[model samples]
Target chain A: MTTPASSTADNHAWLRRQARWSPYELAFWLAVLIPFWVFPTYLTLASQIAITALFAVSVDLVLGYAGIVTLGHAMFFGLGAYAAGLLTKAGWGEPLSGLVLSGLLTALVGLLVSFMIVRVQHLALLMITLGLGLLTAELANSLGWLTGGTDGLQGVDVWPVFNHFEFDLWGYTAYAYALAALFVGVAAARRIVHSSFGLSLRGVRENLNRMPAIGSPWRRHLQIVYTISAGMAGIAGAVLTHTTETVSLDSLSFQRSADVVVMLILGGTGRLYGAILGAAIFMIARDQLSDMNPQYWYFWIGLLLMLVVLFMPKGILGGLSGLLRRLGG
Target chain B: MSEIMLATQSVRKSFGSLEVARDVSIELPRGARHALIGPNGAGKTTLINLITGQLAPDGGRILLEGVDITHAPVAARVRRGLTRTFQINTLFPDLTPLESVVMAICEREGKAAQFWRPLTSHGDAIDEAHEILARLRLADEATRTTRHLPYGKQRLLEIALALATKPKVLLLDEPAAGVPKDESAMLFSVIDALPEDMTILFIEHDMSIVFTFASRIIVLVAGGVLLEADPDTVRSDPRVREVYLGSAHGH
Candidate 1:
């Protein structure tokens, strides 16, 4: 009995230690800020990376943590972009409010869609999400008068952030705004994944059959995480619309959804930092490779993916952590 | 007489032509230790599933503490103080035993929806989970990933998880399945030490463990109960011997 008390305390301490941020995580966030100073000319690309990284993190919340395999995540992202773009176009162009409202709206839709998404599993779930994504893209295309279709939603007028910092051509404000959003999104996600709800999601991912017997309803947990993930993705899309002042039809396309998945796979799934790292690497590689050879960039990208998969199946971050463990031991 | 903790009245289930449960009826009083003994293909696991809401019965009622809960979901049943362990190991392989049990405790406490706070903040749940692990003699293995644990320890972890729910009625479908013979006896000793007020109904193929731990023996044959009586009576009953114990001992 004496041993039980000490052992229980040890378990509690161990869990707290695991939840604490490591030095590497702090260093990663600090490094993210360095681009604003050092890469002044490349701020536009840097902001794009930040927005995409945020999107990747949102995808990881569902696909990695909750074990939801969805191909329609970009539907919510696209919806948020359109929501923010249309709001600014119509006269309500408050940047912060627009972002919040867009995220909440997408969350509402996500909650509704999750009812259907949580009902199925495996291939059926994938098909439903993919079908919904295609349907949204087609609907946007058909409603050209409202959405501007392939010409894109032009004349999106976003006022200066906080009425103080205008979005400059140099992309200083854009990079700062996107970076702030990324930090907030990552911090919130980190909190969620280390919580009981997050642990339950992992349990659902690991063995869904065993959840109910332990008194946890699997569907409810999945639905909550899915809705939250959607909301985060929506916020990322809203950031893009605010920074770019345009909403293209490609924003809601299946390609965007697939690209986020690719980013998550490249960085590793389940871990939040992996998503951000993957996004940064993929976008950087694309920027440099496309500049070098415009028409054949895909060939290089494909080769890089193959190399990563063959050599580091768990993704670069996972591989690095494994190496670090072996070295430390 | 003690109050009935669990009862199934004329429950029926079938997989097309295969009758897994045919008008099956059984009862467990408070604190009763009952062993369900039967030959292979006797539908013991299926009966456990029917009670736990994994598979809906074709007809009849399932009552817990005199409340009919035949149509309740598995989670609802667990919340109502009824829990069960699987014949095969079903666990979170990547998670440590401590994390898994704490998550189970959080679910039991209705705190699983708390996402804003870190898991360590649930101090009560963590302590409770650790207590459960220690009670099951898994304290040393608590921090190891479940997939890396030995087969016997993994089986024990299953029972530990079930206990975290604080169930009043526990149904164990071969809780010691696939464990070594020596470990199986240790497993039963743990089961024997559970709260006296808790009801238990277990399905076991090993007669020696069954006769030692079970105050009463229930012989199920072909989706129906052939005999239900005290172990002394059950051991002497020719029908029980012919259908179950006879073959079990022969092997």
Candidate 2:
């Protein structure tokens, strides 16, 4: 908190600070939350939105902030799901223990894979991560003993909240829990982005030459952010498994990985709300389109993505922001 | 110790088959304003790269306060109080001058790159950035993006960024290059007013600007130091006259 102003004049000055949030952030969130609670179907959709938002947020932390482009983020997500699934199967089914263990297991895998991925940049990073995601799917397929292979590791029963409250399928406890968790994750990420370290990464992105001139080890900073983002992605994946007690090979698939990136771009690249906005649009479109035709649904999405990539290169929210810029100018 | 804050001794660097900076040396004492003048392919910039730790010397040593920093990485060299401006103006194109300076000062203060606390919360850093801009006569341009500024102003912003590093020594690679002819004095005044604690080594093709500012001049001809002399000797030397001014203006 800021030091309380010594005089009335100083207090007034603080009130006028530019960083103070405007009514837009307040009103926009109010609108989003009302819908989630109003519709019965929105509860399930909202929880999925929260999970996918967290996952996409993790990807953006790396892509937008850290400048590591990848399409294989599902590798971390899948690792997290398997971790939660397998721990429950092993009878460590308590909510707190299962959640903590799942995050830890996913984090461990992330640590091992990060050193290799962080060394490459641009398209090479993209290609390597794609390979890594595909390889993870194949490994999940072969590890039938642990993951139940193609059939999946089923019968995961997430132990009750604090060993007391039970999970319901309808619009109740699960959605709220995910929303609370998402708020914490997003708040922490927001804090991290405004820190001195985040400025250094922006400097790195601007010019690799400038970092050393300004006293920053570019590679080391990149590694640290990548590692953190991977762990966060892993935790998001684990949360999905906890909410829905199933882990399958599809979790590790490249298609899931690509979908998350598309969601990230759909919202906005670097904007904080981009991930949440992206995930919401992606899930709603998928749901609406699937109802129309299960097999042909993806074709419409492909068309939408093409139009957005060409005309709205900055993504949806970004395009809106650009519109504001032109009007202001 | 000759009051030299930075010294490059017989440093040599090259790219592939081209030996760009061959056995070059210079000493920048505290408060010394030195100018480097050379023809188009004279290797002045290659030598500047060696001093700034962007290029490791193929041979010889570089010392900051007599301690060898020949192999120090660029970041380490910067923390040791060295800063440089690029030949081509480089700024965060979209960021206003105030934001750019805030970033530089933050780096010097060891702030993490982007901690999510709002940028306005960095009162001290922001104030220092504003002060630097005002000192450089850039106060009016604080809110304007560097890329949108006039060419001469962009050059000053580059120097402002270097100044933000609070360097003990500054290396400027052609600060006046490509600046609009009419805007030359605006850039010159900014460079002229730099604090004396900052040892300056600037490369310039324009003799008028070089002679206008520098106390001492070092002439590089064809990838090596040809002569180090006071302005009087450098101006009168037949060799410098033949090599540089003669080539450019045909005597």
Off by over 4 Å in 1: A1-6, B249-251
Q: Among these predicted structures, which one has the highest DockQ?
A: 1
Q: What tens digits encode model 2's per-residue C-alpha lDDT throughout A60-171?
A: 8888777778889899989988988878878877766666676677667777778888678788899999999999899889889888999988899788877876778784
Which candidate leads in TM-score? 1
lDDT of 1 by residue, A223-254 (tens): 89888988999999999999999999999999
Q: Which has the greatest lDDT?
A: 1
TM-score, prediction 2: 0.92
Candidate 1 structure quality by residue, lDDT tens digits, B181-216? 899999999999999999999999888899999999
* Model 1 chain A lDDT-worst window of ten: A1-10
Q: In candidate 2, which residue ranges exceed 4 Å CA deviation?
A: A1-19, A35-37, A96-101, A108-112, A162-164, A325-329, B113-121
Give the range of the ten consecutive residues with the poorest summed lDDT in model 2 chain B: B111-120
